[model samples]
Target: MLAPFTPGATAFGLAHVLAGALVLVSLMMLYQDRLPALVNVLALHAALLGIAVGWQAWLQRAPELYITAAIAIGFKAVAIPLALHRIIERLDIHREVETVGGISLTMLAGIGLVALSLLVMLRTAAQADALAREDLALALSVILIGMLMMVTRRNAVSQIAGFMMLENGLILAAAGAEGMPLVVEISVAFSILIAFIVIGVFLFRIRERFDTVDSAALDAFRGELQ
Candidate 1:
């Protein structure tokens, strides 16, 4: 069995900083209108996750976590973002993201979600390790914020980014938990890869049929067919 986690002050501080940074990046994604800029932010978010996982590996002495970190940085942070950039350029989709609600309202909702997550997680995980409890709370906030982004954005690409962000939150939680098998991490990574491929193809097909990547347009077309 794994030893009890009793991280020193510096380790806890670094962990808190990394977790907080992920939440901040998620918030940043909320108001981003430009697709390219949003992609860049997503890349940053993934890179931070990689770093955070690496830190967790060091703290937990789980060498397998290093592979998780490498996959996160190499694929999610670098390759995926580069692929998105190419997709945007190939599709010539340079328009600002179409949001369903006012930015102020969406941001307020995001803040509320964060507060709720913190309250709920802290209360429920009270007996857990301090660092794990905090990470779980912050990860929940990121997940909620990502869902908010998905609902508030009309553009398909933005929704895809939000989906990826939600997955990142899951990764954060997994990394925080002790004794999480490497196989579980590998499975999640492969699932994300498969999802990305399917979504990429779906995007191209949508563009081909509708001449736009706006999900709202697809909904309108469905309504017309009805």
Candidate 2:
């Protein structure tokens, strides 16, 4: 008979801390109006994700997850943030991000989303392992917060950061699930890379044509074209 998987207190505690940090970083991203600072926080978010995934790999004895962690750290943490910094410099975008709602209101909404995720996931995944259940709840919170950021921010760069944050949450959920395929993780990582490339192209095009990367400007242009 196969042995049931069980983790030590230390392992579970560390995983919880890392996952909580990721969600906290998402909340921090919500209040940041400066693009450069937001990108820095995004990098920190990815780094925490990588560390969390690595911890999961150690706990699950899943060697494949280490690769996923590596990809998260290398691409999302280092490469993506550096590329974004260069883009900001090249585009000369220095204005504070224009948001659709007040920071305090958005933060309250984020808190509500976290509470909703925890309540729903805990009830839904009652039969699952405790660590995995908690991870899923926090992951959902991060995903919801990312969506909130995307809808509330007007800057294209901030929207892109939000999208990436959502993807990180997906990866966290996958990492927590048993027997998640390495191939699936790799595919998702590559898809994100391709999307980043396409979005970067669009950002330059938008800036060149309209001289602004605020999404509201795109909306106005579309209105004029109509």
- Backbone clashes per model, in order? 0, 0
lDDT of 1 by residue, 1-226 (tens): 9666665977988988999999999999887888899999999999999999899989988888888888779888888788777777767777755656788889899999999999999999999999899999999999999899888886666777888898888888989987688734663666487466636645664332243467778778778644
Model 1: CA > 4 A from native: 1-7, 182-199, 207-226
Q: Which lDDT tens digits does candidate 2 get at residues 1-226?
A: 9666655877898999999999999999999988899999999999999999999999998988888888889878998888778777767776655656788999999999999999999999999999989999999999999999888876667877888889889889989887777735563666477466636645654332243467788778778644
TM-score between candidate 1 and the true structure? 0.85
Give me the displacement of residue 169 in model 1, in angstroms.
0.4
